[model samples]
Target chain A: MIDTQSSSGSKLVWVFFLLLFFAHQDFWLWSDDSLVLGFLPMGLAYHALFSVACSCLWAFACFRSWPEKLEQWADEAVDPDDNRSAS
Target chain B: MSDFTFLASAGEPVSRTPLYVLLVYMGLLLALGVLSSRFFRGTSKDYFVASQSIGSFMLLMSVFGTTMTGFALVGSSGKAFSQGIGTYGLMASWSGLIHSAVFFAIGIKLWSFGKKYGYVTQIQFFRDRFDSKQLGYLLFPILVLLIIPYLLVGLISVMKVVQPITSGMFPDTFALPDKVLPNGKSIPHPLSGGVPGWLSGLVVSTVVLFYVFFGGVRSAVWANTFQTVVFMITGIVAFYMIADKLGGVASAADVVKNHAPEKLIREGSIGDWHFFSYLLIPLSVGMFPHLFQHWLTAKNAKSFRLTVIAHPICIAIVWVPCILIGIWAAGLYAAGDLRIPPLPGGGPNANAALATMVRTLVENPLLSGLLMSGILAAIMSSLDSQFVCLGTMFTNDVVVAAMGKDKYSDRQLIFLSRAFIVGIVLVSYFMALYLQGSSVFSLGVWCFSGFAALFPLVFAAVYWKRASLGGAVGCILATLFSWCYFFYQDIFLDAGAGHGEYLVQGVMPVTFVFLASSAGMILGSLLTEPPSRETLKKFFPTLS
Candidate 1:
């Protein structure tokens, strides 16, 4: 049911990895004088924003690549009849 | 020394209030362990894997708790204090994304396979996947060896945090012998009146062991959930208080800008290669034996959905506060607003950086006690899981498998597991007492690097159809050899000169070892025969 091999899904995975690659480079925070919002160091602020972006990107990865067949398999393993009987 | 006399010491009268809070927290964990055992089914399956019935909420908390060890709190703050805001870029930012990615890629697949095949331990999976029992023989020792040092890091950190917070509580009882230096000035040791490292280490070990010995993995999951909540709340509270004490966010930023501007930026001292190398370290989570065990406890594959979605967010919530506090500590010190504590040997001790900030800034004794308990919560959460995982490995992989499946009864198997857990705790406790001065961050990095080097094996095993038994063996051997070489160079040959500094041509050693292991796996598989057709079909049913 899941289409991890689909073009869009695979592309998203590649994009996420690329984003991570650039995030660690710390290029924007290279200067000691860089400051954001009048108080935060530019580099610290960059990483803080980057962490938020990572959360969003990972959520997208889950939406695109999560395996559907595994969920179905799990449902089959836990029968509805057994639940009713236990109740 | 009378008890009344012991109660009076220098520097703001030590309070027993914090110690009471910690005792209550420990009591709550013990109660949870006892309660969970009421549902035990008296089978090896229930004892080892909770009969695979953990729901999504419990699963998420346990997995997150196990992964976020003392290093995340004590080590991260300490490192950020020394290295600046670059600490977040080095670890938390990457871990947030990579840890969840691994959960999606490896955790789901392993869970499905485990449910279908009735597999409990990682060794069982490797033994069947390669159709070679010898692979388990090779992997068992390496996995345990890597994990022991990781366990010691957690144990050592608990002692470090507790000793300083509880200092001056029992001055006379723990009094130090005064020594006259060549200058003819007699001075008492700094930690003389505090709870010694050995006693704190023993107390934490015993508390964790008590719960684990009673309830097995199920109790560990429950305990982790409780501790995770405790630490998250305390971590945020400590952050707000410290920021206020430093005279608001704007004032603190001004201090850093004027005095220690380097702590704000990274490019000047932390090279590009060093920054890039940190990305490799988080991959070690994929190959953690304890994590693998937690993954296998999922009631079904759906249990993983919440974990994958929420993991990055949870990481952000905990890490941002600790990283900010450490950075603030550096600024305060630079501006001459705070005094950094001297180590026992009389230098600025970075490991005590976070503790000193909290103790100096947060004045309310009740609040301080709660905060200390929260730090211990983060520490003890990981310790319980790691302790149980080792016990599970020793009993399942080494004992039952070697003695033949039918030789031991279920009760005997549980007994064996509990005994092994006790043995491991005692050994690690002694090691913690002996290796008192080692840096938690450096020890943690080495352990993570060794596991990260072996990540190629687990990645290939799940994805690559052509992966052979020879390749798996080669990957393990290459990782071990690289680990030993770097360790020898850093510890012995260099006389600890490169401790916590990126080595291997200015890059972290994980980068080289990861590349070497991957290449070895590829070449070895190409040189040897591919896995049999039936073996490939079993793992990759859709492709076949």
Candidate 2:
């Protein structure tokens, strides 16, 4: 697991997420109905691409901040008698 | 009710295509329910959350399916039909990001706590966190109230779906008369003869309840995986077939450009604040009681990797086709290829827009039946999960917790959950019949807003050590009050039906509700005593 204490990657992942959120507010293309590749509306096409970019950044977030500590705690604190679903 | 015999009298040959497709679809799910039950571990935990052993692929499918309900498929298209192409950008893109974000930030932590504490439902977590059973009891009714509308949504969508897709599938049988609204206008029955609403509704409700009752969470997961795949394929195939029927995707776009250019743009229909507020709707997934239960089913923390990474892409795949299909419907109306949409006092039955387009474009009965089954897949995927989750909450949070866990055997606990599931389904089924032919998709949004409004309670519970029991209660009451107040204004004071849009300062009610909830959370925490150190230490490891 990546170090949560000083991981710039964690911060960057969130920064990218914030950027994506802001980019999602596409006021510039609000009135523009022009098609991308002669099919997708410019707004719809932009958001479609935005969705892809979100996938990439979230993948990074997962790899960077996978919450190893939280999982570790759960593992350590798990009830000994749990035998829950045989994890 | 009068049977038109319109199509059959006009010499349209009747086929049993939709009947067969529906039977196969319903039968498949029932069989799955039986199959899953056979392997059941015969314990409460295993029944409720699949013993928390679901792996990555299963988690992805079940989570995606449970989240992508009738709203994503039916409501988005219907909303897109009414508003514009901006509908996709309005909700889908935000969902792609925000939903996964919530899943990452919120779901994993809850799963950790669940695994550690042997908690099964969200209420257990809240009760433990705030050290207040009162808070848990209060949140329970509110969540139940919010979830009921969604059940109505699934039921109403089926009521809408069956008639249109199966309009000419019979020889002047089961045809309904135009439903007379309180307003002067009426919705002409789709055809003279077709499948009856009660029969279809009963079949769907029975199928979903059967599976959930037998296999509980595991059955819901197994079915959701199958249904998610089915609907995704449905979207693409429907897009291809409808586009090809209209020439091509480009040609369809050209048709819209030439005829209903307004639908292609956002300015005339959607404003920036209005568009931005739609993001709040996606946040409801963060608070969905059903989705919380699904998260607990993950085999491990790492099982979420596929879900978080691939969710946005999955949303894009389903939503794009549904939204595009809607805009193309506008093109159909513009070119006079389709009739003027029948407007109730509020708006056209946008719910029918997608189904109507399918029938108008596709000629083959077999193909139409298959496509319609895909819509059923989308609806029932969430329905089964919601049914089981309410049961889980009743068993773990309400009954078992109050009665003392040691008092009841595992079999009795499972039985209580199953009994509750049947009750809710029956209640929702009756509600569906009571509110037939109403604007279901719009009411579904209100439910989303209600859930979205309470999201901060869960957020602060997870993130903030200073959060008090009072704060959690205050946050929930604020959500309830603000929601009820706005709902009152939008429905009674403002006149519910005609305009059909509910907004405060050009933004959805959800925006104001969310802000109000956050404010309540902060103020209540400040005014009241801080949570105990032991409680904080349990959740926030850094404090320890």
Candidate 3:
């Protein structure tokens, strides 16, 4: 289980880097004219920045929440009746 | 279409058919298929999922290879061609990545259950999860129905692209009977004439079917590894060659900025909501039977995880060339340097776009033949996977489910699986000849939507403790209801304004159906009592 999580964690890191590449591409959507609002200003750099922020937040959230879920699952495994307070 | 125009349009006339190269490629694929058939002396499990012993690398390759279908290459190129540089932005590029993410997030749990219960089909897993025999039976046909069109679409797209090239080279031998287009022009059928469409379809399908039949998950894995490498390199190379002809990758931006700005930008007329919905279309991919089957075949959690991670990166490489060349083609056409001959049927004219680009860029016949083979490889990779998935599901899930599990031997099941594979190919070939669809990409998207509608019930069955039998059944019914409604409203209803557009906004009816299923799963489970502990133990022994 530890090895699985570690490998999955490293994968998340690789994904983070790849997302960085997509962002660098300034991947345009449609065209500047079509984005009438121009509020978000679409470009690869912007996307890269946003993706980085999102990935980081996701990682943090996963780190914080995964253990609790794991503990709950483990508890259920030990005794399915114990966690009868089913969702 | 006559050979006279084709010869006249060429930059330079060359007699070489690149026959050796073509023979080499065809020989290699056939050899792989025939050689792998020897491994069929095993159980159905070995044939279907390779006894769950697939490695990470093979899994990764198969995932990438199968997903980047011929239509993905040509149809995506057509999209890039017609949409300009920005179509990639509109593309469900992140679908592969997100699907992988979903698998990691929820798939590990499902895999554990699969290991515990020995679940063979996705339908079987759902049956155990919901504890509803009725729901299992209800879903069996729906899953099969939804899967067939997706398979049909892949087969048609491959035939559309590969047939033309094959006919161009071996006109007398491989070309089929001529058909009169809607515009009243006669052109040779790529899959039908000398070899006959049914025969060629059967032959091609047989190659893929035979491999998957005997090789099962193992052969598919190994063959996919070879095919994926070829697909990725060929895609990158094709794009590079096109870009070099234009100038370079750096020059692509300049070319688009100056010549095809409209193509580069999305038009407001299409509506932002409709465009945004394109993003949601990919969600359905995660729910595809074939993809789920691949996930089920994973040897371990690590293989599954690695597959999810590496799959997306390969997607980026596969698409980069297609998108780049598409932009180049748009620029060339816009510059009045190329004339896209009118297609058999008058629509958005995407079919001729990629072919035109290949004609303009390629000079050497041998290189052109290799490049053509690359495209065919892309098509076969996707078609093979689709047929294999369809055949396996039909035999294992529907046929064997009705017949008691103990009644059939492993060899009998394997034989049935191969037979079904061939049967489906013939149906799809006939369907493709008369079927009127926009492009392979569009067909794929429509298929994804159909599958996505049911994903909620499916996902809940794996993860939700309260996903009841009633809920699973309701979910399947709701999805089908929404699917029929969408087909009637979006497709059948004569709202004909845009070019064969069926979806509304980014939200499809399937989404609503999925929501209904989610409600069913929650309410149905709560209203009824849970299954017995013994039943739960039998269903999910490895949960702990």
Candidate 4:
């Protein structure tokens, strides 16, 4: 996450990756575990695996983009004058 | 003739081209034109809402088509097939109720706002409420992202069913049709590939889009009336057919209870968590931009409420046929009385099983044609509105606003909207090409969750005195964050690939995110102080 010196707020983009990581880990569990009520279609099972894999990559993208979103949010919140002379 | 010849002859007589069916479809369209003539006028208001002159009866029928589509017809029936009577128990029924309740609670507020401001589209409300064109601009892209996939799925499914029925009209020479199957009953062998499926999808799409392009929402409403009738009649026919096959309702219920008890009884057999998670789906329906757009189109508060009251009964009736048949289908397939062909690899096409059920019950060529039309009607009724809304969002909110500076005239904007509809259809078609995951039901749920997250903010914006702009922004972003997380985990990570694991086990993490967002909105607005009394009074002049 990008550092916003003014308020030190965490960027919103990080949330996406965090969710994605968990989702992927969940898929792996679904695949390896024995579902007690596993009456689902085999196609559903296959697609579940596919969704998990795709999410992992999206999470990576979110991680990389966090700094940018943070910078943008900070820029929106603060005026340039406060930092101009200080810098 | 020998016994073999007799059997062969029987099969041959049962199959016939879908010629008269195409003519019937055309006649239905012409009738729609005549019925809608007096209702149609030149202005946008006339097109969008019939000048808010619609009565409760018409409003009720049209709204039915607004939400029910191929998914409900195909997917819900499939669920009933596998799950039994219990699927319609508390879980599904409550979700349906929540959807209605949210509409009444949130919908009345929206309709009131629309009445106050004469709002036309989803973007119009966001733009005015936030006091920022920027918010409308921001939302336009998101609406497109959500709506187009929905339109593509509806159109493709409709075409998939309608194609064989209309093949006789188009003929092999006209559309480069191939004779892969000896008749429509058998699946086509590996094509010495002929005209692409997309080509057929495009042809059907163009026809639906034409009315929406020329007539806009008015066309959608009129067409919806016919489509809704078709949906209900066919649904009833389907239910009766299935019920009869099962030895009437009482005997059929007994067979289902004994043979497919798991499905017949809704005793949390599917697991408590799974049943509960399903709640978010119908709840999300009222919040979808297109659905709300319909709400705003209502003539008065009384009509709106009456329409809401009628929908559940209509839906309950429509759902019965699909569910009962699904139950019967599971039993038949399991007992070796029926065979459901598997997809190329090994899995069942549970989605197509409903269509297969229809193909089984009706032997007459004409009746089969009518059944096919009912399915297509279900699909197209939903698709048209989706396209109209999708294209309108892209043109009105995104392209025109982004271009800025007296960018286009009203006529130009309307034309642009139509072009975007076609563009959206193409993009969604491509996406469908890549999709091999999730049944229509599951996919529909996933889509609903995202929009459901947005409902509360809008509700507060209209009704709460202290709903500050700051609160709206915060709520919107928070909901967005929670939605992305839930879908990412539920779909891609948990359902798609072996990449991530769920952090919070059930729908709670997602639900909590929404709750937190709502709380933030309430607190944020309360702390910030209300907008200037003058600003409020100007926007809401009726407030004494």
Arrange candidates, best DockQ first.
2, 1, 3, 4
> What lDDT tens digits, residue by residue, belong to model 1 across residues A1-87?
122344588588768768676766767656656667876677777777777777777677767766776555543453322221100
For every candidate, C-alpha RMSD to the true structure in Å: 5.4, 4.3, 6.4, 13.7
Candidate 1 residue-wise lDDT, B106-223, digit = tens: 8888887677667778888887777787788889999999998899889999888887777777888876666445588965544557777888889889989988888889889999
| iRMS, all models | 7.2, 5.2, 9.3, 18.1
| Number of the top TM-score candidate | 2
Interface RMSD of 2: 5.2
Runs off by more than 4 Å, candidate 4 = A1-87, B1-14, B17-23, B30-40, B90-92, B159-200, B399-408, B436-438, B494-504, B508-513, B523-530, B538-544
List the global CA lDDT of all models. 0.80, 0.83, 0.60, 0.57
Query: Which stretches of model 1 miss by more than 4 angstroms?
Result: A1-7, A73-87, B1-11, B177-189, B495-502
User: How would you order the candidates by lDDT, starting with the best?
Assistant: 2, 1, 3, 4
Quick one: best DockQ, which candidate?
2
Per residue, candidate 3 scores C-alpha lDDT tens digits across B180-242 of 677799854422322233444555666676567667666777777787787677667766676
- Report the error of model 4 at residue B23, Å: 5.4
* Candidate 2 structure quality by residue, lDDT tens digits, B1-544: 1111112121365577756876888888889999999978999989988999999998999999988887888788888878878888777899899999999889888998888888788988898888887777898999999999899888888877776666656635665566566667875555446566677788899989989888999999999999999999978988898888878899888877887788888887877898888988888988899999999998899999999999999999999899898888877766766642354453457877888777767667677777888999999999999999999998888887687768899999999999999999999998998776766667788899999999999999998888898899889999999999998887678744454487778889889999999999999999999987667666676511
For candidate 4, the docking band is incorrect
TM-score of 2: 0.94
Ranking of models by TM-score: 2, 1, 3, 4
Candidate 2's C-alpha runs over 4 A off are: A1-6, A78-87, B1-11, B177-189, B340-347, B494-500
Return the clash pairs for model 1, or none: none
TM-score of every model versus the real structure: 0.93, 0.94, 0.81, 0.74
Candidate 2, pairs of clashing residues: B346-B497
